[model samples]
Target: MSLADLEPNSLHVVLHVRSHPPKANDFHWGLYLHRDFEAGGTKYHLKGADKRWLADHGTTRGVFKSFLLIGLCQVARIPSGLMKDVDAMFRTYDHQLNEMPGLTCRTWVFRVLELLQKPHSGQVLLECNDLTSLEYELLSWGNANALAAADCQQPRPTHRSDLCGL
Candidate 1:
């Protein structure tokens, strides 16, 4: 599903590769943090052992953190629950980040709707098999409706003359 499906105030933290040029249109994976912890906090600390630990797990961790910085700058607001989900997602992927020695990470917030309008061109779509059947159905319906509306013509505005300048 497109990032636009996220709620209006949903917050997303993003990061991108510094070596790559930014794009106008793209979808990037974002980490949604809990609202209570949305503001800046104690800095994330990764050292030699931690880095080695992550590397031992896989490559995705480092990739995820690098991208978090970019998404965070684009987010405006985020729902509390979605934020929690993001934090949990990060923890789930922490192993990947721990492997990168001397790598840096940053964070920011923006309106979910706004970010979706200008997503990173290099972003990747993640498959969410965790969604319930009903949730999936609803998402499908919403996407279909949005597509149909985008293709439809707008109704013309009608003119009226009740009280002309006196």
Candidate 2:
């Protein structure tokens, strides 16, 4: 989607998994914040690159993209300053190499999305086992989720409690 389409002051957070296989030191990524990532501005993310290959072309390699579409309550001015909380909450994720235990940029993005109460928690945005396989996995998951949502919306049969007074 075009950055211009985004309403003003709407913060967007995206997960960009690095381009590398598991067990590779270069297998890492980060949560990027920007209306238009390719346009570029102050982007936030964990910083690391063990190999030149990843370093050269790792950023923004993840094809799986999602949006937060921050509401006023999420980033609104409050008793605690908005920017203050924003910095504290987001900046820490950009910690230098190996600082956050086992969490990489990929995990960090997942956790951040979960913290914001986004769906698909604990799942990688761009797992690189096999591109074709991953596509099928995502499609199946999406279909199941849609079915579950549809089921929830279906009207339930009326119960005796509804006519108890009669």
The best candidate by TM-score is: 2
Candidate 2 deviates by what RMSD? 15.4
Tens digits of per-residue lDDT for model 2, 82-155:
33344455554443434555655545544554443322234332223343343343333333333322234222
Look at candidate 2 and give me any clashing residue pairs.
29-105
Per-candidate TM-scores read 0.24, 0.35
Q: What lDDT score goes with residue 128 in model 2?
A: 35
The lDDT for every candidate, in the order shown, is: 0.29, 0.31
Best by lDDT: 2
Model 2 regions lying over 4 Å from their true place: 15-29, 32-41, 49-81, 93-97, 113-166
Q: What's the TM for model 1?
A: 0.24
